[model samples]
Target: MTITVSNLQPIIAILAGILILIAPRLLNYIVAVYLIVVGLIGLGVLRHFS
Candidate 1:
């Protein structure tokens, strides 16, 4: 199986939804981390490592 940028968003959203449902208090941290990760990926910082 292969993963691509186009396919990552929904997977991340689903996971985030589940996490928020399980622990509402973690919403802030989860969103912050998700944004940071997405930003890094967008900037191609993570592509090199992968």
Candidate 2:
């Protein structure tokens, strides 16, 4: 029942997919946010906060 860091991406992906299917217009924002988050993770920017 625990939500670990490793479990986040797939969860987010599923939610994003669902959201996109429900509202196609949100695809742009969803992708933009996902990319920004991933880029920040890649740069280790969010590591300090965790």
Candidate 3:
């Protein structure tokens, strides 16, 4: 299936979940990175749609 912008969040969530499951210690870093990335997206700093 094609990966559109809408599909990116869930895919990332799934991957993050798996990573967290494998290594619980990564929770802090994962959350921090996720928030930063999402914030950048919201601010149009990272344009996946363009």
Best model per lDDT: 3
Sorting all predicted structures by TM-score, with the top scorer first, yields 2, 3, 1
| lDDT (Cα, tens digit) per residue for candidate 2, span 13-40 | 9999999999999999999998998888
Clash pairs, candidate 2, are none
lDDT for model 3, on a 0 to 1 scale?
Answer: 0.87
User: For model 3, where is the 10-residue window of minimal lDDT?
Assistant: 41-50
lDDT tens readout by residue for model 1, 1-50: 67776777788899999999999999999999988887997888999523
Give candidate 1's whole-model lDDT.
0.85
Q: Quick one: ranking by lDDT, best first? A: 3, 2, 1
> What stretches of model 3 exceed 4 Å from their correct place?
none
Clashes of 1: 0
Q: Score every model by TM-score.
A: 0.78, 0.82, 0.82
Task: For candidate 3, write residues 1-50 as lDDT tens digits.
Answer: 97766778898899999999999999999999989888888899888742
